[model samples]
Target: MLIRYTPGRTGLAEGLRRAARAVLYLPTACRLARDPGYPWLNAGAVRWLDRHLAPAMVGFEWGAGRSTLFFAARVARLTTIEHKEKWRRRVAHLLARRGVGNVTLRFVPPSDDPGRPGLRPALWRELGYEPHKPEFAAYADVILDIAEASLDFVCIDGRARVACSLNSLPLLRPGGFLVLDNSEWEKYAPIFTAAAGWPRLDFENGVWRTTILRRPGGANG
Candidate 1:
């Protein structure tokens, strides 16, 4: 025989207490969750960082938005690149609002037009970054068509699958890290093939494929 018990006063009170705690914590959790910066990175990338590159000098995020803000807070220095003026301003404002001072946001102009070869010169100049300093810049069709080759960690959450992979390769140090989002895209298959020799971890769940590539050397790599 079984006894079916409904909530009596104490049970009801306990349930109410749990509900109250959830409600009380809801706003804070929501605030953190909705923060304009720091939306979750790919799980594999996060794990790789925790294991390998968390203590590295600095990191460059190729498409400045929420992720850039998040990474800036965690790293020693964060250089974020966005091509659109509007997004650049938004990222700047968000960083300021979040009291994040280590982030340097750059608005990279289009270089696809042969006439605009020097379009990004002013941005680098304004930032006082030497031509040799490691920097990441985004383009509509490419994550980083041009950047320094001494990058510690490169996050590719932008466009131009093949171009991004090619441009990102040189940026990594011997034991650096590279992460690419939307790896499930069929067009990026060749890029994966190119990276076959590197140590890689991948996760695909129908909608997205996140691939984390470690440069060939060192503990994390």
Candidate 2:
């Protein structure tokens, strides 16, 4: 396993570890730079998703990008929530040009709200993300409108992912999967803790990590 970075604890050994990990991921980074259409996740996670996701499955994602395009082709229907208008439009154009018809893209931008519930203040401070961005609370809540335990898959790869994952936990049907990219970050520790009983698989490529959790017998999504 690659060593996780810890602030204020790095020394010569940690620096060397970082360099080694970067070298290990060089080829993957090069290939991804050349082909941006692929989901920007750990290769193993992508492979697992390819093997597991079925054409009849219904899905939702918190980010709209290559993943949106990738899932649009594989799933029966997909709903993507994007925070940036420009990127969402760009993805929409790609979908139109590629003749992908199964995706419903929704744009939800950040806004200031005083009372919107989300990640705790300490967690936000630790993550270096703005605590005042209340739009993510609403963005995550978009899935609430769908019937509980109806969705087959949910992927959280965008902003406020912690909030998204927590909100999404109840919407996943039993045996459904929840994919969370960038799972190595310390800020995301809460998700693993909150999803205590989920059967989890973690794919790591030294640089990037993705965690897939199977919703076993529990609450409906």
Candidate 3:
């Protein structure tokens, strides 16, 4: 599916404000880049997850990084999907070195064909992480192997996030959380529309927003 970004909401003021915030965040971003175990989420979101995530819960995340170690430490088990080969190997080393046994890391590279089904080129360009081009339909679809409503939480911080978010909703147990990092982007508008009734909480920061949406209804519903 070709998911187009809606640029309508991000006017000149929003652009300028984000640019200013990006400048302000440079120091902190630099520090975070050096720390491999620190999740790239806004600090408020990290605190929220620290408070809410249980030791017995199972979680899945798109884009593996320091967050892999973070979630693996907190949750009973974590399944992480990554598209980069070298990065995946590095994270795997980190997991082994740290003795984090709860994570199952999978490397699902971008599709060789840009015209492959469900590929979203526009969304990928907006993400701007194209070391190998933005064909992550298969990467996002990796979650489909897990049974529906089985996940306690799903985090979308990687490529093809809109598609990942769409794929994640049904996989979450009711009241389960869907965490979206960099939620301030206009390209992710579809998730809000698709998750219309879900209760959402935003951990807002000047540079980026981390959003959490709880699936509504009973646990089995």
Candidate 4:
């Protein structure tokens, strides 16, 4: 298989490493090709999730992608929200191809309130993000409406990630996890402070950094 990555997007060495790792985990690669979950996750993060993400777990993700298929297989219920029509269709096809039925995918474009949060540099430093787009801003309510202490896992990897993280926190059940991808970006530092109550476990996988925050589950009797 030929692997081509843009120069600025990633360096040759890192690309080669990922290719090698993908081959090393060929079995996982195969599984991911069908339904992505633990096998393709960062080894450390996978280990933690494997030990904790029970079959009956329920999860919600801000962005729809491979993780959508990932959680669909592991949990009893999984809800993923996406703003991009193309991406949503791709994920839907993956689910249908795998014959997996546990996941629900929704299209909630950006909100249109006053400043158009996505375009507000003060609220979000990034431009043209889902949060900034009037078409994608409505997604905030999809996540915000989830009842408190209802979700077993949450992945904030979409537009307005910091804002998404803040909204996701309340839905996590005790012992639930919230995964924040691209943790290495300095712009996301506010998430750490905002989510201070959750125990943070950071892992660097190739060029990406993923931070897993665990909601404190009170001790068992």
Sorted by TM-score (best first), the order is 2, 3, 4, 1
Off by over 4 Å in 2: 3-18, 113-135, 217-221
The RMSD of every model to the true structure, in order and in angstroms, is 13.3, 5.3, 7.6, 6.2
Q: Global lDDT of each model?
A: 0.60, 0.80, 0.79, 0.69
Most TM-score-accurate candidate:
2
- lDDT by residue for model 2 over 1-221, one digit each (tens)? 76565557678988987788779788778868887667887889988999888899999999999898778878999999998999999999999999999999999877653333443333334444443336566776666677767888999999888777766776788989999998988888877876788899999977778999988963432
- Score every model by TM-score: 0.64, 0.82, 0.78, 0.72
lDDT (tens digit, per residue) of candidate 1 on 125-188: 4334332112222342233444654777777775444545655665677677777886766666
Candidate 2, TM-score vs. the true structure? 0.82
Q: Which regions of candidate 3 deviate over 4 angstroms?
A: 1-19, 30-35, 112-134, 218-221
Q: Best candidate per lDDT, number? A: 2
Model 1 C-alpha RMSD vs. true structure (Å) is 13.3
Return the TM-score for candidate 4, rounded to 2 decimals.
0.72
Report, for all candidates in order, the number of backbone clashes. 0, 4, 1, 12
> Considering summed lDDT, which 10 consecutive residues are worst modelled in model 3?
115-124
lDDT of 3 by residue, 122-156 (tens): 43344442333347667776776778889999999
Candidate 2 clashing pairs, residues 3+ apart or interchain: 149-221, 170-221, 171-221, 172-221
